[model samples]
Target: MPAIAMETYQDHFDRPLQERSSLEPAWLLEHRKQAMTRFTTLGIPTTRNEEWRFTPIGPIAEAPFAPAVSVAQSVDQTVVSHVGFADMECIRLTFVDGRFVEDLSCLRPLHAGVITGSLGQALAAHPELLEQHLLASDWWHAHPFANLSAAMSVDGAFVYVPDGVTMDVPIVLLNVATAPGARVANYPRSLLVLGRSAAASVVECYVGTSYGADLTCALTDIHLGPNAQMDHYLVQRQSPTSFHVGALGASISRDGVFSSLSVQIGAAIARNDIYAHMGGENVECTLNGFYLVDGNRLIDSHTMLDHAYPHCNSHQVYKGILSEHGRGVFNGKIMVRQDAQKTDAKQTNQVLLLSDDAKINTKPQLEIFADDVKCTHGATVGQLDSDALFYLRARGIPLEDAESLLVHAFAADVTDRIRIPIVRQQIDETLLARLPSPQH
Candidate 1:
C-alpha cells in the first residue's frame, strides 16, 4: 500500500462507523457519533500544544493506517504464549486486531454476579450497564485519541465486580496486532469497574510482531467504589516498528485504593496519557512506570493525578533507560485542589542515558491550591555512576554485565512494586532478553 497524502488529521483517521452500527444499540450509535464529533473538533495535538510539545506525531498523523475490521486469521497457542506470561492461573481474554477471539481465551469460573467478557458482548447482554460506564468518564475529551477509541473501537475486555466481592484470580486483557502487508490500525478499549468494598486485580497487556508499521490506539477506564481496592498492571511490548498511543482514565471513591505499575518496553514511537481522579476523601493511589528504549525509538509518558478530596495520598515513580539514539519524555503533574487538605503527594522522574546520543526531556510539576498539602516533585537525567561502574568491574564483572546489573537495579524501584509474581517474572525475562539485543 502506498502512503496517503498529508491532508487533514481527520482524513487519515476517518473510519466508517455506519457500516458496523446495524447490530449496535441506537444509544451506542449516538454515543459513537458524539465521540466522533468530539474527536474531529479536538483534532490531532501538535508540538504547539503544551501537553504534546515534546512528542512529535507526524508518523501517526500522516500515515495511511487501514482499519483492520475483518481479519479471518487467528493466532495459535504458541504465538499467544510467546507474548504473555507463560504459566499463570487466571481468566484470560484475548483480542486480535481489536476484536475478541474467544477460542484463544480461557474464561475460568469467576465469583457469582461477576461479569467478564468482551465489551461488544456486554453491550448486548447488559446495555444499560454498559451505557453507564463506556466512554462516560470526564477525561475522555482530553485528547482526540480518547474519543477516537470510543468512536472507532469495536471490542475490548470488560470486567465488573459487585459490592463486597473478592476475586482471588487475576483477569488479563491481552491485545495483539498482526503483521499485515498494509499498515493497519486498531482501536482497543477496556473498562473495569469494582463496586463498594470489592477487590480485584487486572493485567492489561499489548504486543505485536514485526510489521510494516502497525498502529494501535488503546484506551482504558477504571472506576472504584467506596472502600474498593485494585491492583493494576499495564505492559506494552509491541514490535519495534509500530506506533502506539494509549490513554487511561481512573476515578477512585472515598477510602478506595488503586495501585498500578506500567511497563513500556516496545514500539518505535509510543505515547501514554494517564489520568487519575480522587473523587472522595481518604483515597490511596500509586502510579509507577518503567520504560526502556533503544535504536532510535521514542517513548513518552504523561500523567495527571488530581487530588480533589481531602486526606488523600498519591506516590508516583517513573524511570526511563534510553540507549543508542532513543528519546524519552516524562511529564507528571500532581494537582491538589483547594479543599484537598493534608494531601500527601510525591512524584519522581529519573532517567539513565546509556549512549551519548540518547536524550530525555522530563518535567515533574506540582500545582497545589491547598495550604496544608505536602506535595513534592523531582526529575533527574544522568548516566551510570562512574565510581559504581568501576567498583562493579573491579569485582570481576564484565563491562556489559556491570551495566546490565545497574540497569536492572535502576528499574527495580518500579518493577518491584508489582505484587503479581508472574507479571514480575515476565518483566524480568524481557529485561534479560533486551540486554543482549542491539535494538530494544
Candidate 2:
C-alpha cells in the first residue's frame, strides 16, 4: 500500500463502529467487526503478496478513495438502454454507487417461491436466511479486499430460488457507478442461492459513468444445492480511468452443474478472482473468460477449481487480447483432493498480443492427489500470425482491415462460447471499435 493512500484511508476506515453497525443485528455486527480487524491487520497487498506479484496496485493504494454514497439522480433510465441486454426478457435490479434504486429497477411478475431484491432489504425481511448464508463463513476473511468489502458493504443485490423452481428467463443484477467526481469507492456484495433441483441463469453487470480515477471492490457468493443448475455471467465495463477488483466464490453440491462466463473490457487496472468448490459427487463445473485491453491498461484473472468428492469433472478456458503497451495476467489452478477419485479436469489459457509492446504472463497449474484422476493444464502466448495477415491482405483487404480480421479470428473461439445472442453481438461490436491500430 502507498503511504499517502494508506494514511488517507485510515481516516476513512476509522468511522465509529456504532455509526456503521447501528441497523444490523448482533451477529452481523460481530461479523463486520471481525472482518474489519482482519482488514486492518492485513492492510493492502503489495508486490510481495504472491497473488499480486504480477499486477502492481500502487495506483489504487495511493488514491484517496472514500466509500460511495447514494445519489438518486445520478442514474437515469436512459443509461440502462445503452448498456446492452436491455432487450432481453429478464428481471432487472439496479443499484447506483452501491445503493439500490428501487425506482429505476424493474421487478414484476416474479416466479413463485423466488426472492430477489436489495441485500439490505433481504437482511431485514429474511434475517434467518441472511444469517444462514451471508458472512457466515471464514472463507472471505483470508483476503484483504474481500474483508474490506464485507466490513464496508452497505447494499447490493440478493436472489433466492426455491427448490424445484426453474426460472424461465435470466436475472440481471446491474450495478452502476455515477460518481460526482474521482476519489470515491464502492463495495458491492452479492449472494445468490439456488435450492435443490432448481435452475436459473444470472447476469451481473458492473458499469460506471462520469467517473475518473474511481474504485470498485465487489464480491459475490453463489451457493447451489443438490442437483441444482446455474449459468452465471459477470460483465465488467467500468470507466477507463477507474479501478476494479472483484471476487467470485461458489459452492456446488452433489450432481449440481455450475458454469460461469467472465468478460472484461473496461477499467484502467482490473483484477478478478474466481474460486469454485465441488463438495459432492458427480458435480460439474465450467469456467470461461475473455479479456481485451490496450494502451497501458492491465487486466488480471485468477481462477481455482477445487474437487473434493469422487467422480467430478471440471473444465476451464481463458483467452486474452492485448495491444499497444497493454498488459495481462492469467493464473489458473485445478485441484483434486485424495478423496476425489475418478476426477477429470482440463485447463487452458491462450493470449494474443497485437503489438511488440503488448505483454502477458500466464500460468496454468494442476494438482491431483488421487491416483484415478486425470488433469492437464497449458498456456500459450503469441503475436498475430503474419501468414494469416498476409493472406487476408492478398485478398484485397487493406493492411489495417487485414490486421483486424486476423485479430477477430483469434477472438472468435471465445466469442462463440457466449450463449446470449445480444451479448455476443455487443461484444463483437465493442471489440472491433477498440481494436488497436496495426503498426506499419
Candidate 3:
C-alpha cells in the first residue's frame, strides 16, 4: 500500500532552507527567516476569506511540490526565439524551470546608467539596493504567497534606470516552466527601480510547457522616483494543469507617471493581485487588465489604487471573456485618504460570457475620506448580443463565423488599448482562433 500522503503546504514549508542563510549577509538572512515565519503563521487563505471567497485553492494547497532549482538540461534556442515579442529588438532574459539561462539571454549594449540582468546577480553586486527595495511594498505582509516568494525565490529579473536616462526599447523577461515527471513549484521575483527623471518600459512574460500539477508563484516590486515615468506589461500563460499566483506592487513619487497592462490567458487556477500607491502629489497612475478563460479555468484579478497625497489621479479598467464553464472574478478598490484632496479616480469592470455555463463575479469599490475629490466605479456582465449575431448572419456570414465576429468585437475594447503593436496583434490572433463554434 502507498504511504499516507502528508499535508503538502506544511511539508514544503517544514523542509530546511534550500540555501544556507548563515553564509549570507545578516540583513538578507534575517529577512528570509522572518518571511518564512510569517508565511507559516499566515498559511494559505481559504475560501472563507472574504478576499478569496470566489476562487478555491484546494488543488494548490494539496500539491506535493518542491522548490524549483537549476536543471542540467538546456532549453532549445528555437523555443526561445519563437515566443512573444521575438521580432522586436530588446534585451531579453530567458529562464527555464525558474533558473536563469545565461547563454540564452541578451543584455549587452544597453544605454549607460541602465541596469538589466538577473536578480540573483543583482543581489550579489547591488546588495544595498536590493535590500532597500525588496519586499518593501505595503502589501508584502498582507498575503501568504508574497511571504512565501520572498522566503524561497532564488532568481528573477532585475532592472534599474538612473536619473535622466530613458530606454528607447522595452526590456523583456521570459519564464518557461517544464515538469516532465513530478510536481514542482517556482518562485520568480522581480524588482524595478527608476531614479529621478528616468523613464523606461518593461515586459514580463510567464509561459509553461508541462500540463501537469505545478505552481508558479511570482512577485514584482516597482518604484518610480520623482518626475519618473514607467510603463509595465505582464503576461501569464500556464498549462491547464498548473496553478499561478502573482503580485505587482508599485510606488509612484511626486510628478511621476506609472501605467500597467496585465493579460492572462492560461492556468487552471490563477490569481493576480495589483496594488499601486501614489505617495506624492501630482502623480498619475493607470491599471488595466484582460483575461480569457475557458475549460473550467478560474481567473481572479484584485487591484487597489491608493491616493496618499493631494492632486493624484488613478484610472482602472478590467475586462474578461469566459467560455465553457470558465469563471472570472474582478475586484477593484480605490481609496482616497484625508489629505488626498483634488484626487480623481475612475474604475470599470466588464465581462463577456460566450457559454451559458460561463460565470463571472465583478465588484468595483471606492472609499473616500477627502472632501474634495472625484471617484466613480461600475461593473457589467453580458453575453453576445443576439441582434448583432443576426445582423452578421443576414449579411451572408456563416453562423459560426458570425458568432466569432461578435466575440472578437466584445474583446476588442481591451485589446485595442494595448500599446505594443506586436503584443496586441498576437493576443488578438490568439483570441480570434479560440472563438466559440456555433451550435446547431
Answer with 1 or 2, whichever has the higher TM-score: 2
Candidate 3's C-alpha runs over 4 A off are 1-19, 72-74, 437-440
Clashing pairs in model 1, backbone N/Cα/C closer than 3 A:
none
Q: Rate the local accuracy (lDDT) of all candidates.
A: 0.86, 0.86, 0.83
Which scores higher on TM-score, 2 or 3?
2
- Cα shift from native, residue 343, model 1 (Å): 0.3
TM-score on alpha carbons, each prediction: 0.94, 0.96, 0.94
Clashes of each: 0, 0, 0
Candidate 2 TM-score, C-alpha based:
0.96
Provide the lowest-lDDT 10-residue window in model 3.
1-10
Model 1 TM-score is: 0.94
Clashing residue pairs, backbone N/CA/C < 3 A, model 3: none
Candidate 2 structure quality by residue, lDDT tens digits, 219-326: 899999999999999899998888999989999999999999999999999999999999899999999999998988999999999999999999998999988889
lDDT of the structure predicted as candidate 1:
0.86
* Candidate number with greatest lDDT: 2
Model 2: CA > 4 A from native: 2-16
> Candidate 3 local accuracy as lDDT?
0.83
